[model samples]
Target: MRVDRKIKASYEHAIDNLDKKEENEQLSEDEFLERANLRSDLQDLLKMEEINWKQKSRVKELQEGQSNTKYFHRVANMRNWHNSLSCLAIDGQVVRDGNVIREHISKFYAELYKENVLLRPKLNGLLQYDSLDHSQRDLIEWDFDEEEVIKALRALDGDKSPGPDGFPMLVYKCFWHIFKVDAMAVI
Candidate 1:
């Protein structure tokens, strides 16, 4: 234990010396390279610290039966900086600006919607539907109760893509007691 402490102290002292050396304005080429290497090592240490905290917190979350896959995915995306589009092809030309990318996406989806409008079948039949039996009509138009909503929410996959509200079914399940009334109202 004493030897380990001494070694740690020596390492810290060496780090302090390197820091001082880095701040010297008259550093030689070799010293500059060494300082750059030390800076690189410091950056790596900071990255490792971030990763270590994430891993430890993940272990705690797993112990509590909470999945951290999404959290890890978010962290990985932040580290990789992949959310921004580097380039996109629009109108037979490559565009790299952010605003242009958004416009391209909007125009593309708008054109897709226009194309889909053409694909819709025209209902030419004029009131040619027969009335359903009492039970069949009741089944077709059954009202949803709180219990049914809860059951559907419970059956949903937590990892599935969220709806437009940006909330997964897992959130609904977790906060069901508080939001049940509002959810049933929406239904």
Candidate 2:
């Protein structure tokens, strides 16, 4: 990656100033040592900043290419192959037709989800729950404020799976101030 113009300019300016300081003959030993230490610290900070920038750039590149990468395609293809329904056994006979398999799956789910009184046990009065008070009801129905939103965002695990927008909670948490208004509007 190319060096940032501002960083490069600042680094060059610091080096130039250090060189000018070093050329001065009126400086004492303590002042000279202090200047040398300051120069070293500045160089270290600049190097660390460069490394930080590189890491951020690399992470951005990986995120942007995630859906298009060869590795992603390979993994997706493997998962599909593993989960594909190529054959089904019914009545001790193997069925290989795709349409038949689809129909069978559809019918299976339809029956599975179909409501059947015989399959469900009645739970009337089996469990009781306290009703919410007026204050509790009001709180539940209240609009989310910025502080609430920020608290919720902070409560999420940063390293968990990305949301629908393909960004992890860490991004939102880190940039809450910048995105607060937009996020609140969406909410």
Candidate 3:
């Protein structure tokens, strides 16, 4: 705590020193205003840096939570998380930002690991579908409304690649198999 207090005091002193240096310099009113704006910018940057540091600590905590498999839950309960990711549908504003996806997908992957007991060994490996190459992959396993992402992918001439689950539209195969339906309907 004392160290932290000292660091804070030093940072404040540095800011003060810079401000004093600007004040000491005799300049035009416009130049003085510009120096004041620089000081404001420095303050804002310091605030942003503090926020980034706090978020970094939170991210580590979330990672530990994921390691403990906290995100995984029964199907009925995990549906809400699935829906949250899937909500990145055509209408939502969530874009392809790495940090956003990192936060969301850590939970998603953790939940996925929990649900797929049959593939428990594969889940342990956790690297199957995550290796589609950087050019084609987002490096974050988000549930961007597959429908919309597919549309965008097509627009970009993306090849028909398999999803984290499987190829597009093939997701229904599970339903067909589970319900014991005929393939004729799909054909």
Candidate 4:
């Protein structure tokens, strides 16, 4: 609610002075028109943020299920996929441990999102999911050795610097546990 009010106030200020010509009377009509459109664009952005904030209540409900069982199921699926990929890499000759293959999937996700946004058009444009040729192709399918993978996970849980690039790796460890205990299937 506070954010919404703040956003509304900002919009009112922008609308009150859409035409800069009021202060600098020498300004042309074209510049004034462009500034007016910018205010509209920012208003739309604020509206979207407010809607997303409210929608979060539903998301939280879905995530906070009957118990932590749902969370475990989510984790298990991820470990299964990651473990399978590790095994594939070992068996396949085409793919090795490429430089970008982070134990934490978040890093790659950020890269993909950043690249996708950079390649796409400006606001109101459709998002394009493009393949990133920047990193070398990885034919690896992931079959991380069971024991080693488990041990590595335990180590990662206690890792000193699992942070992304620089920031602390808080959520990374949480996911690691989710993958190790909840995601991994029993033999």
Which candidate's lDDT is highest? 2
lDDT of 2 by residue, 82-175 (tens): 4698999866889999998889889999999899979788889999999999999999999988888888777889999999999988998888
| lDDT minimum window of 10 residues, candidate 1 | 1-10
- Cα displacement (angstroms), candidate 3, residue 91, comes to 63
Each candidate's number of clashing pairs is 0, 0, 0, 14
For every model shown, what is its TM-score relative to the native structure? 0.31, 0.37, 0.23, 0.23
Give Cα distance to truth, residue 112, candidate 4, Å.
Answer: 58
Task: Give all candidate RMSDs, comma-separated.
Answer: 19.0, 25.6, 25.2, 24.2
Q: Name the best candidate (by TM-score).
A: 2
Instruction: Show model 4 residue runs off by greater than 4 Å.
Output: 1-21, 61-187
Of candidates 4 and 2, the better by lDDT? 2
What are the per-residue Cα lDDT tens digits for candidate 3 across 95-146? 5665666667687788876776565564466666545776556645544454
Ranking by lDDT: 2, 1, 4, 3
Candidate 1's clash total is 0
Off-target runs (Cα >4 Å) in candidate 3 are 1-25, 65-187
Report how far off residue 148 is in candidate 2 (Å): 1.9
Best-to-worst TM-score order: 2, 1, 3, 4
**Which scores better on lDDT, 1 or 2?**
2
User: Residue by residue across 1-187, what tens digits does model 4's lDDT show?
Assistant: 3356666677667766655447667556875776677677776776665566546544655777635555445544544554554522323443535443444355657766676656676766566667756343443444555676556645754546645556344454566556565435642
Per-residue alpha-carbon lDDT of model 1 for 1-187, expressed as tens digits? 0124454455456667876766775677886677577666655655665676567657766786766566656655565563467899887899999898998899889887776666778888955978899999999899998778778888889878898899887887898898888878888
Candidate 1 lands at a TM-score of 0.31
Whole-model lDDT values for every prediction? 0.73, 0.76, 0.53, 0.56
Quote the lDDT for 97 in model 2.
95
